[model samples]
Target chain A: MTDAIPEFKKTEATKVGITGSALTAGIGSATRKEIAIILAVAVLVIGGLEFVLWAYDVPQYILPRPSLIAAALVKEFPLLLPHLGYSMVSLLSGFTIGAVTGMVMAAIVTQYPLVEKVVTPYILVLVTTPMLALVPLLILRFGFGYTPRIIAVALAVGPMVMINAATGFRRTDSAKLALARSYGASTLQIFWKIRAPMALPMILVGLMIGSIFGLLTTVGAEMVGGGFGLGNRLTTYSSMINMPEFFAVILLLSIIGILIYVIFFLIGKKWASWET
Target chain B: MVVKLAVRNAGKRYDDLEALKGCSFDVADKTIVSIVGPSGCGKTTLLWSMSGLHSLTSGQVDLDGERITAPRPEIGLVFQEANLLPWRNLMDNILFPFEVKHQTPDMAWITHLMDRVGLTGFEKRMPRELSGGMQQRGAIVRALSLRPQVLLMDEPFGALDAFTREEMNRLVEEIWLETKTTIVFITHSIEEAIFLSDRVIVLTKRPGRVHADYPVNLPRPRSLETMAGREVFDLMNKIKADIYGMSSMRPRSAAE
Candidate 1:
């Protein structure tokens, strides 16, 4: 048994080294292959759709060809660019306000029983009631400008953020809390050090979901009311029987949504790397 | 040496269950005391009371003649589970107590403690990446970073394998000898209690009270070889008999 000890240690060390090297190489190759596959699939699917549209001779007025949408986008480049910038500003401002307000409200509600009891029912109602139905009422109250649209987006996004953040904060481990207490940590110290870091990944989850909801609400409100945004352009072009321009605006909105999701996803992965 | 801790008639009750009744003990400065009892005998409850993590229904705990109403930095606690923050690496975890108290930890002492605990090369790894024994070592280091006058450990190695548990016990004894910190370690193993302690306090079953207080006469700087002697086995059998409430069934060889 004594003679076996050093041999055992040597074998174990070798095993660990081999496994570590294999894991690093495996992850590197897997990510590269995944990216290549995604790019190839996107090209094939988009190219197939374009080919089918060409073969069928689909009318550009009804469902604009991809080429026609691209041309329309270039033709209205100057006008689309400024309006796009304006819509983005509204979306970002509304999203930020809604996310921050929701997170603070969640922290308060979870920390205080009285606050939770008072606000829980109201939150449930807000989540269930469609913000789209409230846009017209808000427009009548706040007028046909940016105020109604921004408020609509905030109202639509707030509940998701509140619910998700509250759940995350509540899921902190009791043992960690006890450890902090034993170390003579005060209430605020425990919250900021243990609870906050533990809840971060979930909080980011809430922000991503809320941002998407905010963008959708912004588009919906702009579509229903007067505006110079992409959604408004879609409505105006469709009403004027300009299908290519309408399709072009819709495509732009989809791209914006994708970009927002990608940005939040990268942030979450970077900051919350400790979370499983 | 001064008396660092005194528990006077420390009793605790939970709604309908009596956890501890009339339990009292005194720990002198720079000594190691171990509390041993069967499961559910309030060994943990007593430790928590000493740490001021739980309030007693009756009686008082005094630390260096001052009444303890809440947990303070002067007393450190290590739980059965490692309970290290998963987000923190080993060094940050060791520095947690200092961070919470808004004091800068002594880097030289921390490095020395890490070396003493056989964790010299694991300063940058996350808790999840560590083995159970390594995590417990980190927990011990974290507890000691504050330079606490008294350390309360509740089965800190109960979850580790026997080999690792023995290694940890030796390491703890070495640390205690070097630092001279008063320690109250709770465990269920009689051999463990006798091996590492200056005195062992045994508690009776539910609604626990002190059953026996045996001052271990073993030599200082104890090693694994100390546990192999006949005297150690004799004491282990004696404590075992007492714990099992089988005083009549004491081993024939142990009678001498």
Candidate 2:
């Protein structure tokens, strides 16, 4: 009887273990199938582009061959690195300043009706006026160094961030606001805890858009004024008729923009997925 | 217990339209008070004024012996809708008041409250992931987590199905029994008011004033059985008659 009891218990345990393993395997297989489909799609798209490039004798000047761009990238690493660093510094600094100031302004505008009314028209004007047009004025005022580029980037990006953040802050549910008030939440606490978290996904979107604009403005300003950065190199290359180097800088800028977008996208997925 | 809330000649107006006029009532401590009326009877406005969420156009609201100027931590409010913060998970939503007030939530109390509400093991889930009943359960947990001395609920569980609403009514009765928190719950359902309240306050249409205040002498630890009894049915009919009779006297638009 003792031996039978032990044997039966062992059999039950093994059955349960096998069932658990099967369930895990089923989930894993499903996930793997999805990933495989995505990877196959990506490879096919990239391969099709390569075939087109090979079939049509597309000139290097119009669009450098991917392999040729790769070669240029490998060859120009040292030269690109410092310029990349400079652009990154300018982008990060300007983006940080613009985002913080925009948030503060949005908070003020949201809290005070008079401030919102006063700022709305100005924001609308800024939105309508192109940032590129103001770059020359910034350069004239701040000179041809990093200052003009940073200021230009900040000016170009601030309104978008401010508008998006303010909308997010203002769009909180009245019911939740009433609930918060009923719990005796102070204005600052309501802003920080309820309004801020609720606004995060929208704010991140603003940040992403702002960063892209900041980078673009930095490069645009650099191009407009003579500088020692990648934008300046692009201007020099174009003036000297150096197509390969010009294409290389363009590739670098595209990669930077994509990187900024991907980073913020991942953050939105990880932190704000609850929004769905 | 002494009177915890007193409303004396309290009135609220929105420009030309008066919502409540000369509304007066007193609620004893450690008791549940239900305010019942038709849709536009200003029951919600009265609760909002009591919790200091809305300003009184005339007269005053007193909590204990002191006058209420603004929302105090001592008063907790629950709306008809769950209104759980979507970005926050269940536990975080419950803990929101603490985070907002810069006070550390009592974890033991939160856990106990969650257990009572049957929300255990669902703490990490977002409000959207839960069913309507579950979301309302989370909202209740959130309100109770603050341990407020006075609880003001406006049509809480009004969105629930009949069965779920009945279940929640019992759950609320149990919580009130244990906590002894002074509760003023607003509902248009006469049966709900009778089942859950120590006293039921009825109001008339726009420029609402108390039409009747009936003390429900139902026994403690009320259950589904309490709802089925003769006294409960009698009280429910009386409240219905009071509401329908008063509402019928007014013009169509004004009645609504």
Candidate 3:
């Protein structure tokens, strides 16, 4: 038994060393591999699609080739820039307002059960009512400009953020709360110090979901009423049967959606990196 | 010795379930008292009441003659499983109590405390980076940072391996000797109670009541060799028999 002690210690030391080294050393290579795989997959899919379109001699009206879409993207890039800027402004502003209010609503409701009871039904109705349906009514009230589109985006995003952030705020570890209480932490102190940090990852997840919803609502509102944005360009190009430019608008919107996901992911990585 | 901490007829009920029933005990100044009992005997509930984290349905806990209605600054608690904040590094966690009170921590004293607990170099490391024993040591250092008049620990080493638990036992003894702060420790281990405490208080299962209290006459700074001696075993047997006897009589008592 006495002899076994040193051996156990030796093994434990080695195990700790291996894991410690792995954590610091493995990250760069792991991320490199992740990027490599993504690039390889993109190459295979895009190359294969381009070849298939060319081999079948698919016409632009039927389905444009990848090369034609690429040409349209580059040639029409200057024309698309202003519309892209317009869509981005509406998407970001609405998402920011919606997400911030959602967090505030989460805090208020979690703190006061009565407020949650009174507000939750309307939130549920808003969430399930297909928010884009209100765009025409908003336009009729506010006119065919940024106001209706932004409001539609906010309505789509708000409920998702509120529900998610509330769940995160309430899901704190009971033991941690007990520790804080044992030290006589006040309700506000508990909320700020303990609950806020613990809820961060979930809150970020809510924002990510909210941003995506906001993006979709922005596009939908543009399609229904707005005379600007990539969604409007998409309708205009499709009406003229300019399929390459239509696909180009689709590509731009998809890129914006990807950018939204990447932004939230990076923020989550930086702030909510601590494992629960 | 004058009483440093006192519990008077404490009773607690969670709706219909009574966790503690008129439980009472006292610890004199600068002495360690271990509360031992069978499973579900409300040892933790009693400790929480003492810490003022939970209120008793009846009676109160007094620290230096002051009734503990809320968690007092003079008292600190070490919970089971270390309970270190995962988001904070060791140093930040140790200084949390000071942060809560809006007071600047005396860094020199905290640094000294960390050194004593063998957590000197790991101050900047997150809780996840450390082993279980290391995390518990950090927890201990955090509790001791404020120099509380009384320190309450609830099964602080219950989750550790036997070897690590024994090492922690020695660390606790060393801390108690150095600080001479009154301590109320709760555990189910009879040997642990006899090894570290001045007195062992046993409780009956469910709606816990103090079943017995045994004064340990073991000499100070007890080593593992000392714990292996005959006298320790004799006390262990005595407590064991008392617990077994209680279990045997439980059915009859329940019928009444």
Candidate 4:
């Protein structure tokens, strides 16, 4: 029994050593491998489509080849640039307004449970409403201008940000709180020093979700109302039977979505690197 | 010697369940006192009460003749878990309590504390990056960072493996000797209590009171070899009997 003690302890120490050594900056080779896989799949799909379309002499109206889409993208760049600018303005401004309000609401709710009780039902009701269905109402209330488009984006994005931020604020470790109290730390000190940094992962999660939701709503709102966004360009090109240009607009929107995710990914790596 | 902390008939009740009926003890200044009991014996209740983290239902706990109403800056606590904030690195974690009190840290003292605990070069490492033993070591130093007059440790090494647990005992003993802080050590291990403390105070089951107070007459600066001595064995037997032998035999009296 006594002889087994040394072996038992050695194994335990080794377990700790392994866990301790594994604090990699989460954006390690795993992330690199994932990005590689995504690029490889994109190349294989696009290259295969281009090859099939070239060999079979498929119609441009049916499904344009990768080369045709690339050409259309280059040719229509001048017209698409203005629409892209409009969509970006609505997306960025609405996301900023919504995400900031969500975080602020999260902080206020965390400090006062009574405020949370009053606000939560309205948030839940708004969260369940679809972004597409709200455009008609938004247009009716605010007219066919930037206000309606921006409000649509904010409505779609706000709930996700608020939920994640609240979760992050509330999930602080009780042991850390006790330790702080034992040292006679004030409530404000504990909130800023211990709780805020610990909640960074959740707050950043809110931002990522809000960004995607903003992109979707901005495009959907523009498509519904038909004025000046990538979505509006989709309507115009399709009406004119410009399939290649329409596809190019879709590709641009997809790239913008990917770029949004990439920005959040980099921010998470830099700030909440301690998580993994 | 002056009495540093006195727990006078402290009682705690949670709704109907009485965790402690009446517990009384006095710890001398600069001495190590260990409270030992069986599981569910309200050992933690008494410890929390003494540390001013929890209020007693009956009596009061005094620190240097002053009543402890709430957590004071002069008292430090070490929980079973290291409880180091995972987001913070080693240096920031240790500096936390000092920063909370708005006091500038003594760089030499902090560096020395880290060096002695074998965590000198690992200051920049996050809590998760350190081994369990190293994390606990960091927690110990964090608790002691503000130079509290009394240190209350609630089974600080309970989660550690046997080998590391002994090493922690050595580290704590060395620190206590160097800085003669009044320490209230709570644990369930008989050997651990006798090994580290100057006096071992044993408690009964729920509604816990002072069942026995045995002064360990062991030699100073004791080591692993001290466990085998006749005096240590005799004391351990008495404590074991007081805990297991009597409590189990009179089970009905315990719940009352």
Per-residue lDDT tens digits for candidate 2, residues B1-256, read 6999999889999988899999999999999999988888788889989989899999889999899989988888888879998778799888888877788889999998888887887888766667677888888888888788999999998988887787788888889988999999998778888889999998988889989999999887787787799988888888877777876665357557
- Per residue, candidate 1 scores C-alpha lDDT tens digits across A1-276 of 111111124344333432342111122223678999988998888787778888999887767667778899889877789878878876887887788889998987899878888988999898778788898999899988888888888887888889888988888697799899987889999999998888887788788788888888888888899766777887888889998788778888889878877676566545665554
Question: Alpha-carbon error at A81 in model 4, in Å?
Answer: 2.2
TM per candidate, chain B: 0.94, 0.95, 0.95, 0.95
List where candidate 2 sits over 4 angstroms from the true fold.
Answer: A1-31, A239-244, B99-104, B229-231, B248-256
TM-score, A chain, model 4 = 0.84
DockQ scores of the candidates: 0.39, 0.31, 0.44, 0.45
Candidate 2 chain B: 10-residue stretch with minimal lDDT: B247-256
Proportion of the native interface contacts kept in model 4: 0.53
Question: Candidate 4, residues B101-180: lDDT per residue as tens digits?
Answer: 88899888888887777787778877767767888889988888778899999988888888888888878888998999
Model 4 CAPRI quality: acceptable
* Candidate 3 CAPRI grade: acceptable
Better of 2 and 3 by DockQ: 3
Candidates 1 and 3 compared: the better one by DockQ is: 3
Model 3 agreement with the true structure over B1-256: per-residue lDDT tens digits:
8999889999999999999998888889999999998888899999998998899999888888989888888888998999998778789899898888889898888888887877777788777667788889889989998989899999999998888888888889999999998899998789888989999999988899899999998888998888999988888998887777768454355557
Itemize residue pairs with steric clashes in candidate 2: none
Q: Between the candidate structures 1 and 2, which one is better when assessed by DockQ?
A: 1
lDDT for each residue of candidate 4 in A198-226, tens digit (9 for 90 to 100)? 78888988888888889989999998995
**2 versus 3: better lDDT goes to:** 3
Show the lowest summed lDDT stretch of 10 residues, model 4 chain B: B246-255
TM-scores for all candidates? 0.87, 0.85, 0.91, 0.90
Q: What is the lDDT, from 0 to 100, of the residue B175 in candidate 4?
A: 91
